[model samples]
Target: MSTGHVEYASLNGTHIFKLIGEVRAHSCISLDKLLNKIEQQQNVVGAIVDLTQTTFIDSTVLGVLAKLGLKLKQVHHIQAVMLSTNPDITTLANSMGLGQVFVILNYCGDPSVCTLELTEEQHVTHSAMLNTVLDAHKTLMRLNENNQNMFEPLVKQLQKEQDCLNHDVQKQNA
Candidate 1:
């Protein structure tokens, strides 16, 4: 698979996130942070995710993107649009119940705007990575019963690890 990088552009109040190449859990932290920032932006009226260039997207990236769609729908009352020409990726999105939160489209008209690239954070803590992974799976679970069944064991394991990590932190602090 091709190496993945994230590129994005904000046009007026509509924000477009373009995923190129292979997108995986490593890029999810930056993507999550960007999504949070956009959610807090008062001017955001729309959201779009372009996956035309995406060769692969793992479950973590899918969860993060799904969270973005859910947040846009809940906060801005706008259904996020997802542009995908690749059949495999499109099938994955549909199977994940992403269609409920995002309007899947085959076309994305060119937008005349400069794009910025998002890079992964240099140093990510184990706790933070664990939290991101756990949260991403939880978000996925919330999408449908199929997802819930698919991710329950992983979520349970992550939750246990999180509890232990919290206990360790408390002990060190004490």
Candidate 2:
């Protein structure tokens, strides 16, 4: 039910776009359009997609990114960068073999803390990689916390039922 919005900005010589809100089937159309526009930019050397604000991203979104990466590579010779703290999203991206296709950056609050290692013509340091990982970890933790809160009641109810079942078995034995 969440809507996805993308905000574009030029930062540190990179065309940075932050994907805000939920990335679902409906949002993919708009996202695809935006990506097409970004791809057409002559000044864009590379692209960084910030998914920290994105609460949900489905497989369709991943496919779109994969296609975009391919197009960018073939046409502009530009690489893509993914910046997100969502483990599910990250894991999905990794599973789809998109990790090797794009440069995944780790971002803590300050984007500067994150360093990107570019294979094309730019080389970055490992510390920057660490920072990016740390940032992603922070986002993962937040998602975990939110998930825990959402499931706490169901967990407690299941625990209560389990306790009751155990008590009934003991009574029958007695």
Candidate 3:
């Protein structure tokens, strides 16, 4: 597998750190250095870890990312977003429960990407909405399991009622 190369650029006031090639043990040092620079930079409001070009990532590299995430959360309060197209890496992150800790996003297909300018308030609102949706989904799944029989019947009744209401409305219109 090819070794990793760390690239840095600034986009829309955010620091973009792109990890190209395979992220093995050696890449951690360079990644750490880039992260440190971003942390020290006052103008950087957010950081994106672009892993679109990464072919492989070892556990050691994951450990480094975990540590960096923790440090950023504690010190700078900077939200680190991971943009990866690699299925293996995405699965690994999901299985490890890293998604809850970081803003992990998948960018598939077209590689031409641009930074989105989001206000601080908008970012917070979006994060809150995401959390609310996840919580609601979990609650719905739990309710479905708890009242499977009741839910199925209730859903059927609602569908029947909706059909009747639609028929009545059509009749009235006609």
Candidate 4:
């Protein structure tokens, strides 16, 4: 599988993100930053995640997307839309209860409406990556019972890693 990259564009009040190749936790920091920027913007009307070209996406990216869906609903009172052309990706999203947070459609929306520019990839620290991963799984677990059961053990493991990282940081500072 090819390495993944994220592209983004803001058209009018709508924001669009395109994920290509295999998206993983390494890309979450950039994705998270974009989501934060959108959340802060006024006049934001809609959000769309285009996964037509996405071959593979890991749990961390999914969690960020889930978090985006929930935030859009909570802060802007608008439900986010996710476009997935691949059946496998669609099935994965559905299994993770993304349908509850996003309007999962099987077709690619109007691509000509906005030009998706590539987001600048940012390097991630181990501490940051672990934190993002842990928070993401926790968010996914909040979606439904199935997700909760599926992610609880992973969350527990991530929490342990986070604790260890924190301890090491403290010792270094001491």
Candidate 5:
């Protein structure tokens, strides 16, 4: 059985990320961390996402990707190239209107030829994951009206869970 993985490297001013295996909601935690760091970078001139080895991507990961693309564009005026050979993924991306942010491709540049190592996964709490999911969906909703319509229910559900979690933490503290 294959687990999800997110690997990354920075070559000069170009940042490259490779998402492998099954990318699920939990993967968003790590991806969001990277994205936060990426957003703070000033030297990055371009970005690429390799999904060639990605077997599946959950909505949370997809939201993280959307956030990445929007950030790169807003910060650096760069359009992110998303590499994927899976027809299903490509179709799904199109259906979800991700093409507005990402330039989906079937192949990557020579970055894949380099020796890249996986980033160590940071352990995160269930609450943290839910928080990440909530933020990710909010980012998606901010993209456009269509996304807002599609993800409003999910965002509300996540927000409700987050509120409950916060209340539980307060009770525990009390």
Candidate 6:
């Protein structure tokens, strides 16, 4: 099944990113690309992550969003607001200590003015995906003590998977 997708629009200075359906590691490439595009914009002041229609969000995606928020704050001196009505998502963000990075909102004003720019999904190698997932989890781990405790096992698992994949690729090449 298709995991998830991201749509984004830049209006004025704030970039609006909408997460539709379930989001996983597969969506990170496009998301990262979009982030780059947003960075190139002339007058970017902030960003908003809309999760109103999202049904599921994996740890990797959450980590990516958290990192985005922190970068916007620390580097750009702007706030990244996450528009989410789902209690589960809100709770998860709080649990991961993302509240420090994101400003969660239940409603949005004039979203109609924003149109999403959707792109074809990017294909990533197994090792690449594994690395991305591992890095995302590491980012999450830096959020708080609880996040560190929660993602430590996942980080170790990803590391093991990456190691196995590397070995398999090496054997195939040999």
Report per-prediction Cα RMSD to one decimal: 1.7, 18.1, 18.9, 1.8, 2.3, 2.6
Q: What tens-digit string does per-residue lDDT give for candidate 6 at 19-138?
A: 888877788867866775666666778788888878888888888888788778777888888888889888877888788898888874465655665674556777667777787789
- The residue pairs that clash in candidate 1, if any, are none
Q: What is candidate 1's CA lDDT for residue 118?
A: 88
lDDT of 5 by residue, 1-174 (tens): 228778777888888888878877866666688789989988888888888878898777888888899999998899998988889888877666678899999874464355364554467788887888898789878877888999999999989999999999999999
| Residue 122's lDDT in candidate 1 | 78
Model 6 alpha-carbon miss at residue 152, Å: 0.7
Question: Model 3 misses residue 109 by how many Å?
Answer: 7.9
List, in order, the clash count of every candidate structure.
Answer: 0, 1, 0, 0, 0, 0
Local distance difference test values of all predictions, in order: 0.89, 0.57, 0.57, 0.87, 0.81, 0.80
* Quality of model 3 by C-alpha lDDT: 0.57
Better of 1 and 2 by lDDT: 1
Q: After superposition, how far is residue 109 of candidate 4 from its true place, in Å?
A: 3.5
Task: Estimate TM-scores for all models.
Answer: 0.94, 0.55, 0.55, 0.91, 0.87, 0.83
Residues 101-131 of candidate 4 have per-residue lDDT tens digits of 8999988667565555565455658888887
Candidate order by lDDT, decreasing, is 1, 4, 5, 6, 2, 3
lDDT of 2 at 161: 58
Q: Say which prediction, candidate 4 or candidate 6, comes out ahead on TM-score.
A: 4
The candidate 2 region of ten consecutive residues with least summed lDDT is: 113-122
Off by over 4 Å in 5: 108-112, 115-122, 172-174
* Model 4 stretches with alpha carbons more than 4 Å out: 111-122
